[model samples]
Target: MELRQYLHAHGKDSIGIIGVSWAEDRFGDPSESRLQRIAAFIDPKIPVVRETDDLVKAFSPLEQVPANFVYNRSGKLIYGDGSPKLMTKKQLEGLLAGSK
Candidate 1:
């Protein structure tokens, strides 16, 4: 299962997934329609937000595009990587196992 599905099925209301798109430096706000389109490709209904000053402060600095950060329920950063493999089911299981 994907991250969202995995979380929904086994997370037991403990996990929430959100996507942050980092393109403000090059393209700026993608607008509501584009945000919706991005959300369309995302399974399990995850909220996708554009980068902003508040988001930067909340999510930490973005080193590159597709920065992935995993935060605990207390809002503390746990796992972070820039690799797309972060979506792999096995890797996600490993990432979330100890988190629970």
Candidate 2:
């Protein structure tokens, strides 16, 4: 999903973006660059990260799976599921807006 819309829906809230290569093919590296651009353009304060123990971390080789996972500040698992549903930009926005 596009970062700006997601941030707008969250409205000052923070969210992580973890990419699972095997989970979804909708997001590719080239498109990720676009998403990054959107992030920079809109929600620069949200913070985007890759491979960190923070809010977000993109992983590859999903089948080589690890038991570990990252959680949100609320202690919710943000990754490590088998084939997560691909979140479209609008879907993400809706979810974030509705999240408590």
Candidate 3:
């Protein structure tokens, strides 16, 4: 099963997922209207957070996009990799099992 489906079926209450996007202001800062339009385009099912600046630097001095992180119940990062791939269902299940 895919990560999204597995989360919904098994870990919906125990896990949370959020997607983040950086504000790439190369040419110029996009107007509020443009930003709103972009936000509207995102899927409502996925919770997304937008960062105007590099907030990852505060956690770790690494400038990597498409980072994946999994935090335990205590809000401690248990898994972090600068890759777009998500944890497999088995891997997530193992973590959940260990927590209890």
RMSD of each: 3.6, 7.6, 4.8
| Better structure of 2 and 3 per lDDT | 3
Report the lDDT tens digits of candidate 3 across residue range 67-97. 5577777887777755555567787777767
Better structure of 1 and 3 per lDDT: 1
Q: Any idea how many clashes model 2 has?
A: 0
Off by over 4 Å in 1: 1-14, 28-31, 81-87
Tens digit per residue, CA lDDT, model 2, 1-100: 3555655766645666443223223344445666566556765554544443332233333343222344545766554453434445675545445555
User: What CA RMSD would candidate 2 show?
Assistant: 7.6
Write model 1 residue lDDT over 11-99, tens digit each, in one string: 53556777777664566755677667766665537777666789777655556655667776677777774544345656667766777
C-alpha lDDT score of every prediction, in listed order: 0.64, 0.47, 0.58
Local distance difference test, candidate 1? 0.64
RMSD of model 1 against the true structure: 3.6
Ranking by TM-score: 1, 3, 2
Residue 3 of candidate 2: its Cα lDDT?
A: 51
Q: Is candidate 1 or candidate 2 better by TM-score?
A: 1
